[model samples]
Target: MATKVTEMNEVKSSGIPGLDTLLSGGFSQGRVILVLGEPGTGKTIFISQFLYGGTTQGNENSMFIGMNEPKSRFMIEMSGVGMDFDALERNGKFSYVDATEVRRIPEQAKVGRIHVGGRELGLVNLIDMMQEGMAKVTPKRIAVDSISDLVFRFPTIEERRPVILDIIESLQTTGATCLLTSEVLSTGEERTVQPEEYLAEGVILLRRLPRKGMRSVQVLKMRGQKVDTTPRPYTITDKGIEVYASEEIY
Candidate 1:
């Protein structure tokens, strides 16, 4: 008799109630997901809760790569949402990497000069830092606060593509599921080229729709997974992001 090889989908719970169902039971393991949204759309809060949830429930370590926010400010903001980032760090279950140092490198490469920004601190260096951090903490979940800042820092898309690819490859090697956030820039007509969306295994969009006087969230896409296509409502509470069921909202 021949033995059948069973394929399994690695899944990580989002920690938000009703979210897993929307994500086909959760995000697939070792896959990169791009979270797109505008400002005040609760993108950071959502990703933070994801890491905290994994740490608390699954005992999984997590690493957060911040491009804009400093460590102190990041912690303070998270604290206001009832997430004890300090405690998680103290427990060795969470880690943070500040990419601001790399950002400080001047952009010497002019348009068409090379491709991307001056290759001072390329993706290789960033990957090195990420690997070093992972070696020490061995996190199962990772989050890159925003890739848009990194992209803008670059001089051209050609240069940015390879660096982004390198980062994605590095994350896959770490065997950690990663959530990469990006800011959406519309061209007033239609959304322009979003390379990250194409590069990632899954993409989730958080958009603010102007309602009677308030805004609501809508999940745009989750590739290769069955998700709640209906735009569910959500709120930023003292305990982070809370997604309401479609039926419950109406």
Candidate 2:
């Protein structure tokens, strides 16, 4: 049998211990990670923990780009998880950008026009905003809360794919490890794959499964890393998503 070869790059801790072990030490640096899940499945908590951990433990600068939520609301949500976003920002280790003002580019030809909600803000403007944010924060780690929101704003999937790819490419240039959250469709219906998944270097899937009248959180996958393949139980506490080691089936 061929054995897995472990790379020597420093492991970036996920802030969640059990999860770190599954990631074969930690996530590879400067790679994009996609976090997909259903509502209330703790996707935001997972990303918050990741950014908080990087700032507190890893001592890495981080940035959060909000799509659907306002920056204030995002911080408040993080506060619920025991992550002091204000303190982190005060400490000069974290920052956020609210990009909910995206619009459509009406001047370009129909083939080139960027359409979102009947208003397109051409790819140039989108990239410009991202670049401007990076210049201000210069983060070592980044997260985009829910890429699905952006996709929905874009009238067609074709218009959205390139933008998503552009965002990923731009982040890679900054040499920051990135975590992007995406929403999955309702369970029981076959889910359509998002093109962003193919662009990302790693993927962590979170889901809520109905079992015996209770709901459970599970990790579906973590690519390029050795992770618990079993359905480990988890809970969203005041400190965020906590996975029980004893419940891990791997």
Candidate 3:
């Protein structure tokens, strides 16, 4: 069964090991969080863990909307990381929306609790699909694997900012803790802050350190909570992402 509705100020565990310690508990309940990182920086795995953990441990229904990856590949890859979405779906605690296509989805279409198949989706249709799914299952945790596709459709940041806000607003309407993954587009050493970083209620950045193959996670900002904001070492284990919150990334 899905968890009960929480107050706006309550903390909701992020579902990743050691991550809660950094957030003084977890993300602010029902707020949207931006998970910023480059390709292969474990962004997908991070959100998968959050969703899986919520269903298995927190008794919360979870939804995953994929904008970049196919549902088959995503399920297979996530299986390698020990997230048995198949089982979760069987138990009626998980749902997956295949939104790889950004065309348009029918409003009257039924939303599935296991996997809602869609040929294409637009920004408006995407929000409609999410609302239909939320109305169907009332999931307490929702995640979008990556919003880069949706954001890049706009020519500039100014155009993208309002779109991102609309997405966030749709997510918050259900009082579910939302996590949206965004890609960092910088090729140079220095980083360019994304507009979503300013729009989200929280921002968590994952990056590859100077040392070869070493990864780190940092919480840049989390509204209504005092986050550590430290650059902590992390790893993508067979089970899932693990953050060494007690240790520093030196």
Candidate 4:
């Protein structure tokens, strides 16, 4: 599972063991990645492991922006998987922005909510807040738990696309590889090009098949490199999400 890291300087370990092998060591160091899936597909767990794995490395830092759930819920959820969410924050190695709280208290969101610019924050303010958080942490990685809430808030795909693109583009400037999770419709093969899927440097899709409750991961699109696009079964346990990179999906 080892790759010549010296030759591929832009690749960094994804921290998810099996998935790393599929990514040729890992994803491009500072590109934005989209993790798309429906409910219960492990998108949250996958990204949580990314942050949790990096923050524990001592010198590396990470930030998680919870746009759909409260910050407390995120701490509780990840802690269930043996991740020390609170301790990392307390140690100043991890930062969290509660975008859901910003929705409830728009005015107070900017004072310390970490916006790119402003004393006023609203529902549309998260992209800016995320940028500010990125600057503060200088994180090696960043993850936005799920972008579904932001999609619902925007009212139309026309409005959603540009804003999402802006957020992804903004994160790129911070020099941190980012993972933005999105919800899929579960309609299978035929699908429209979502704004996030179109703009991201890579897209990893998680699906729960109607038969046998099987869950699988697919590397839909990974720009500028070859990747294993085969669907692989994955598991979510107390340890977290793991992809069977070398196994075939039944």
Off by over 4 Å in 4: 1-9, 102-124
Q: What's the lDDT for candidate 2? A: 0.72
Taking the tens digit of each residue's C-alpha lDDT, what string does model 1 give over 1-250? 9755322256778876668867767877677778888887888988888888989987889999887788999999999998898998998889988765555556554445455545545454567778877987899899988777667666687777876777777788888888888887752237675777778777776766655424344455666677776767777778788776554334
Q: Count the backbone clashes (under 3 Å) in each candidate.
A: 1, 7, 1, 2
Model 2 vs. true fold: TM: 0.81
lDDT of 4 at 237: 82
| Ranking according to TM-score, highest score first | 3, 1, 4, 2
Could you give candidate 3's per-residue lDDT for residues 142-247 as a string of tens digits?
9997888777767787788888988999898889999999998872457778899999999998998879878999999988789898889999878889999999
Name the better of 1 and 3 by lDDT: 3
Q: Candidate 2: misplaced stretches above 4 Å?
A: 1-8, 103-123, 154-159, 212-223, 245-250
Q: What is the lDDT, from 0 to 100, of the residue 227 in candidate 1? A: 74
- Highest lDDT model number: 3
Clashing pairs in 3: 103-121
- lDDT of model 3 at residue 228? 97
Cα lDDT, all candidates: 0.75, 0.72, 0.84, 0.78
The per-residue C-alpha lDDT of model 1 at residue 191 equals 68
* Candidate 2 lDDT over residue span 76-160, tens digit each: 8889889898988887778887766543334433445644433344445556666777777688788888677556656677877
lDDT of 2 at 223: 56
For candidate 3, the lDDT comes to 0.84
- Per-residue lDDT of 212 in model 1: 46
